[model samples]
Target: MSNSGMAIRPVLWDGDVFRVLDQRLLPHKEHYIDCDTSDKAIRAIKNMAVRGAPAVGLTGAAAVALGAREIDARDVDTFMKKFDRLCDRVKRARPTGYNLEWAVEQMRLVVVENLSIGIDAIVEKLREKSEALINEDIEVNRAIGAWGKDVIPAEGAVLTYCNAGGLATGGYGTALGVIRAAWEEGKKFHVFACETRPYLQGSRLTMFELLKEGIPATLITDNAAGFLMQKKKINVVVVGADRITANGDVANKIGTYSLAVLAKTHNIPFYVAAPRSTIDPMKSRGDQIPIEERPGREITHLGGKAIAPAGTEALYLAFDVTPSRYVSGIITEVGIITRPYTRNIRLALQKEAGK
Candidate 1:
């Protein structure tokens, strides 16, 4: 299945500019923000104009390409020095998502391998590398869907959090990709999207994609998940990860750990769907994965309107970690990784590397 027809594309490279579908206006207005410069692209990633792990990674690669073009260096060594700095900045845009660093590193390798080539050729190679990341992400997502669809029950409800749809990837999604694959294979299932709070990516972006695809879905508040699970309304739980540690621990949207805990309590299967790029082998544990902290205003305000007292203090931790013990399986493009996660996760990644 090709992702050519995916209705929602969160990131686009338009030859001249990196185009990001402004997610903040989603479910209300569809808008695209054009980033012709690296700074603009970095700002888009930082401000959540374009989000999701895979999407941000692809955008970061594009930012490196754009930054490469702006380098005034005529020699390969000088260009690489500037390019390294650019990659560092892009990687720092969002610390939680491994894909950002992974994607930028991929771009960096392209330059390193072609150092003998002229600076102009390296720039062109960076462009090609960014485009390759886009295509590769779509293909990887489709493969993940193929492997993960089997986990979806023939006819049951699947609970998901945040926006892991086409809007979250190059095209097809991670968690939502599994759902989409099952749907395409004629398996009937209802989706319950948790309205991920403070950001509302689930209610806005996820629902928007679900409705566009004509999928049967319901929107639920973040805290209502356990009640629904108790009522047996939820059959399985699946979510996308910003980063997966070597031990198979997952760091995702803020409320994902809660869902995982609830799923475990209810004896429901909890799964994480992501491309291999989202895995950080360097991080041996979840705590080693940096959790991004957003501004308190995100919690105290909604759509630029104040919802709390002027001095109300709020803690907006953008993500939370779910231990491998809570995860039933991890669906990757390579395959579904099951426990003993420490060993299995390594084998899965080695398989992905064609080792």
Candidate 2:
């Protein structure tokens, strides 16, 4: 996913020991750690080496598909059992992002749906289908960017929280893609990047990515968004969604809800840039969106540096939900959707989903 005219990010491959841009080394050393085993992949996902709902989901499916290749199965039923176990294992790695679990379940459904095909063929198709899912994300994100670009002001500042860029997707990113498209269209705008707490994905990843593209951006402490709003440093608050409920409520980075609130008080436009896949029509509202409770170590330390006394337990939440009512618009790859997204958005997505 290219944000602000950066570059294309490749999808996870079997032989490719999927390396995560060690978020811990960010703002200093931009490093990527290689994940070679299911164990390594599990650790990476747990450690936030690989995150973002879409990326994690893709990785979970890829990990299972690759793990299936390693299973020494003598028969089709054995392969099925082993593969099911593998998916279950990946599902346990992270339970917050329903996407990860959802993808695994989806892959399983694919396997079950095509059960008529032998295990040998099933394995091959899983790999093929998983690869296609990654490709589909890129295409969807690109379209979302194209569509989101129209909603952004021609010349104004845009605000975002957390990391939603090439590093966060199998290809084109949702929120970052919109920024990239706008930048490419000769739009001169400053990007206000919030330094998300616990894990500063914005300070570490988002800022680094924008700098790579030489885009103009300002770094602000997550709490300072309200001040920025009062000062009128921002015109729009654009965030990426981990999940969007049927009512259009969005689950995103922890600080996103605060930003949405600030934007609402300041009367600024708040938008959610995501692909149709991010929307969960099954859930009725934000109350159903699960929040990721992170390890306490994140709050007590900044990267590898200690910011608190030794062994200080800290409360950490990886996500928060912004009520749909607070959102001005939802910028999807398809287009900008307004309130009452009920029937239209779902119908459109259902059509795209082949439902």
Candidate 3:
């Protein structure tokens, strides 16, 4: 949670206010959207002002807590009704990331347990629970880094797609965390960041983090990834997941599947790094995971400029699923999950729970 002295944090809670780093305008403009109400927080998440699975989850919890404080309910019953509705609204803000639902459920449990105490007590508990979630996210990410760093080569190029650094989570990142940990351990290597199209998160956010931390990194276009691997420049591929199905399938950025396939063909290690909260045990397979579709404007334009003709229409799929077969391993907070991911993921979660 200390951030290893990093300057940027995606989400911050100071007193009653939630200040979120507006990721939509990153790497250039730095601004925080002040959210005092759940609606404001929800909008931030919906608009990509505050994104990433872990960050969204933390935002949802904070929203519930803020909603609990803002709702004008005279009695416990009325308060519970309003708060529960707010929880559902926040959960629905984004459908693909299980962390959003997972965080709401965690906050809901806090409300349920303290409902009998009084409305004020419930509100206070919600605040405490929301803070707990934020702190837990950073801790889990650090643990994930410690567990995953071993996979990084001693001196080789490590490729990452999208933005999964401090800007994507409460503090440390999932895939980037491993890279940072490895770098901290004196593993001198170059990092290749893919300029993820449409969103350009890798170019905008990931590159920003790497530069900030003084990590050696190079930016490449989305299409240039295969060429880099073919030239034997990239050694391993690591990416963060939005949701991991029960069968070990991963749903991440739209182009993640293609990268995974390329890594498999090149016989390179393809790893997914994320906390256990991202693993949705309810979804049996990747096909079962809901892929959120975005507006055509995202694809038809770039940086607020229209690049296509007026009549052009584009289908924007926010995420794509990668079958477990292509994944060399899944790095979690507890440990690395290898083959038979179903069994390993279950056992890892069970162990984490038992702890």
Candidate 4:
């Protein structure tokens, strides 16, 4: 019940200014970016200053509120037009994460429903809604942790990719939340954090969170996951999702699919922990989801220094999809949805909606 050890808050809004922990400078620098305008907020998301699905979404909601406050509309019709454009811009800031669009839509709904209240009231409501999202995300993540803690073995190694921790969400995390919950419940287990290449979020952010929480963890190269799995060092795989399709295909950091494959081959339970908002009902399968290709410089350089030849060409696909069949279970705040994901995912989402 006490998250005293998990003292990281990646996103924060204090009425007027939107602030985000610049994740790009993590482990080395703990800098926070003050986004006073919507453009600044969107830039933070694009530059990876504020990242991870849930964090991005929470920031997007705040960005909408910031934009709404700046709009000089006198009437409902004028406000609605400007608000629509603002939401579209925020949604396009990052195409891969469903949470961004979801959060924007949530703010948009508040605007639509409050049309009778005038522009000033709507702007105030937007601010309130954004703050509410921050609280809701933390609560949802805790619920996910509660449901997923049982999946973690009492004494073993749990493999996780990327930086799904307090750094990845409003407060607590999705996948890391499960591990944290298990740890809090007195489960003895070690964590194998993949040093996700190009970005190194696991090495920088995940390691930072684990150490801060006093959880036992080891850092490993992304490629070393299979070697450890083969040796039976890993008991389970739990990672966060950027987007999940209706059929239960998961889109996460680029190397997630590989880890899922390795976990499946090793006969380890591969779990995807995420909030219900991460699920995209619009996409029936993984292939239908749009994959965001990042700048090639991300692949060609490290720490602002070129690691390859001047003319070297590289591809940077930010994310990859893991088919539902490889997943042992899809962990959500509602519960763990197992095989026959199409049916179970639908049922689980409906259950969440009812709540």
Candidate 5:
């Protein structure tokens, strides 16, 4: 989890400035954007400079702290009003990723609890809390890795979608974290990185990370997944989630649902690795989870070259929901949640609260 080694982190807090690695230009360019204001942080999230559910959540917390440092309010009442507005703005940055709202609420609690002390003290507390969120993200991902690693076969193949590596989160990762943990545990396995279209996070970012770590991985077209599964080349399917409803339905990259369905047909165990913050206990079902529609250009073109005729309308849903029935289990930092997910998810969350 520490970058002191060879790992590169997507998010970092350098003194008062928060830095995020720009993922849009990966596998060719490595760029870091320093966000000194809440507006800058919000823009980074919106523009995809910082992505993945956990990474954005951590960024949201940092954004709140950065906003707090600039607050000019002298009274606690005015400070609360302004802070609440700031939290609302961050929360509205993205709808699919529950982690953003969860992180914002976490940061809000810090401000509310310390408001009686004064704005300066409250800002200081926010700073500490934000930093803790970042550090805790790394720890949480590592814990997820520890728990999910056991699910990996001793020697087989694992199929993963998108770029759920350190580049996707605050430090280690989620699905890729489990992969890394399993590899570190001396489990020999091959990784299939699906070339997730539109964004191509897997082909670009995931491949970059695997190659950097010298992990054995193959780049496959998104549609080739079913063939591989049919051939029994895939042992398990693991992906990270943007949000998980109370019933355990998963919301992830647009192609994730297809992968889950194929895995189900192939009788392969499909797993979702994420931090507890990714779960939305309030949402009873997947249909209630908001789906973000991205620009049509993303689906109509590739690398600035049009794949379709100009003005050809395209649907660009950023994510899709996979029913809990297709999921074999939900991997979290705490542990894996099996069926009867509604009950197990609540029990797991309760245990996390007690901790």
Candidate 6:
């Protein structure tokens, strides 16, 4: 499939040598950053050249494998030691998205699994698996999109927070995936995208994506959501999750919790679109999921432009959690999981993982 001026290959794609969509110059300036070297890859990730949980995760493996390919050594031990350091460093670029960490862990397992299997074999398997990780996310999103399409009312308004669109995942998306499916299904649903304070992922990215697809949408400030809801405009709330706890708590773009609260006050249904892997069993509750506090500059600026004159301080938080009680359902690739997540989420994962 192809979109506007771009090709829709598998979700996990590679741009020139090492360049990724320069999100900083988006919706106005279309650009990509090149990072052929491991060090350069680290800088790209650190500077937000490439982001979104699934996107970053695929990039993580790509960067690591790219680094491994650059390793120069005759001795396997020496080569492994050197590449390990590079891989570990790249993994540190983003500490919040578990996908980055998850991809790294998968890459490491591939290396171990291929031991005594020869360098060529190891590299081949890693490459295949890395690519598969991306395709896996794509397939999951497609399934999620199909199954999640029904969550939205047949003819009602829906609200989404942040930039969980095709750019956020391998291809289709997460919460936005549902929207895509709805569009495909000929559902005439109105979409309200939050500007996602401090980051503006919604305005800068989500809006861009929806417009690209010719989807009907309206952009609004994060605070103005309640007013729209008060007018009985928003009947359902659908957002993406970076991480979800065993207890059903969700962590996503910072203003998401506020939306959830507002939805509850207005008796609107709040829903979360997330992949199964995001469900962390180790973390028993939302409190355990690591909430990333971005640099203070994010709150004081826009698109690398300083809104507050020079030297003004900024307060930034990359994510926030919404308790399960505020959410009505969690749509996954397998099916939709409704409230009372304490055990149902865990059980759902077990059943799917069993497959």
Between candidates 2 and 3, name the one with more favorable lDDT: 3
Give lDDT tens digits, candidate 4, residues 1-355: 2473247689998558889999999898998999999999999999999889999999999989999998988788988998899999999999998999999999999988989988888999999999999988888888899999999999998999998888899989999999999999999999999999889999999999998888999999999999999999999999999999999999999999999998888899999999989999989999998999998999999999999999988999999999999998988989998979889888988894325
CA lDDT, candidate 4, residue 314: 92
* TM-score of each prediction: 0.97, 0.91, 0.97, 0.98, 0.96, 0.91
Candidate 5 per-residue lDDT over residues 212-269, each given as its tens digit? 7778999999999999999999999999999999999999999999999999998999
- RMSD in Å for all candidates: 1.5, 2.6, 1.5, 1.4, 1.7, 2.7
lDDT of 3 by residue, 8-68 (tens): 7788888899989998888889999999999999999899998889999999999999988
* Poorest stretch of ten by lDDT in candidate 2: 1-10
lDDT of each: 0.91, 0.78, 0.91, 0.92, 0.90, 0.78
TM-score of 5: 0.96
What tens digits encode model 6's per-residue C-alpha lDDT throughout 244-285?
Answer: 888888888788899999999999989999888777767788
Q: Which candidate do you rate higher for lDDT, 4 or 6? A: 4
Candidate 1 residues 123-143, lDDT tens each?
888988898888889889889
The C-alpha stretches of model 3 lying farther than 4 A from their native spots are 1-5, 353-355
lDDT of 2 by residue, 1-355 (tens): 2343336353456454555555566668666666666677677778777788788888787777767777888887788888889999998887556578777887888788887777778878877877788777777777778888876777889998898876678756778888888887888999999988877789888888888777799998988889989998898878888888888888988888888988999999998887776777788888887677877877887747889999787888878888888998888765777867786577667554322
Between which residue pairs do clashes occur in model 2?
1-171, 143-333, 144-333
TM-score of 6: 0.91
